[model samples]
Target: MSAVELNPRPVRVSPLIKFTRWSLLGLGILYGAFHHNRFSKIENARREKEEAERPAREARLAAEKKRASEAEIKYLGELMTTNK
Candidate 1:
């Protein structure tokens, strides 16, 4: 009946359980880093590329629209002159 007897039934965790716990922790950290860092950077790059191209795309579209309008006006002017 000494100190050894006092804690004879000390809790012991199984090695398999410890390994599983650590493995899950490592997987969670990997998942978080990939999702928050890698995937986010990829998404940001795509968005930036799209944003950079948007003005050019809009300008091209505006130019096309302007050309179409000018052609229509020219056609109408020719029609009016012929009608007169």
Candidate 2:
């Protein structure tokens, strides 16, 4: 086959098909944006809740650590006295 015979003319696409394609693309973008906005709001609310509870959580942990330290010291003192 010759090079000229191998080449074919480009088929023209209908204007209606092009319009439909573009419209669908725009709709997909809008749908994605809506879902993204919803997800972001939920994520932000979760972050705010975590931040609000941080101080209480830290205080509880610190109190637990202090109690454990005191118990260790008392046990050590008792051991030393028994050894003497």
Winning candidate number (TM-score): 2
Residues 1-84, candidate 1: write the lDDT tens digits. 565585477689999999999999999999998789988899999999999999999999999999999999999999999999
Q: Per-candidate TM vs. native?
A: 0.47, 0.59
Following a full C-alpha superposition, what root-mean-square deviation does model 2 have from the true structure? 4.6
Which 10-residue window of candidate 2 scores lowest in summed lDDT?
Answer: 1-10
**lDDT, each prediction:** 0.95, 0.98
For each candidate, C-alpha RMSD in Å?
Answer: 11.0, 4.6
Q: How much lDDT does candidate 1 score?
A: 0.95
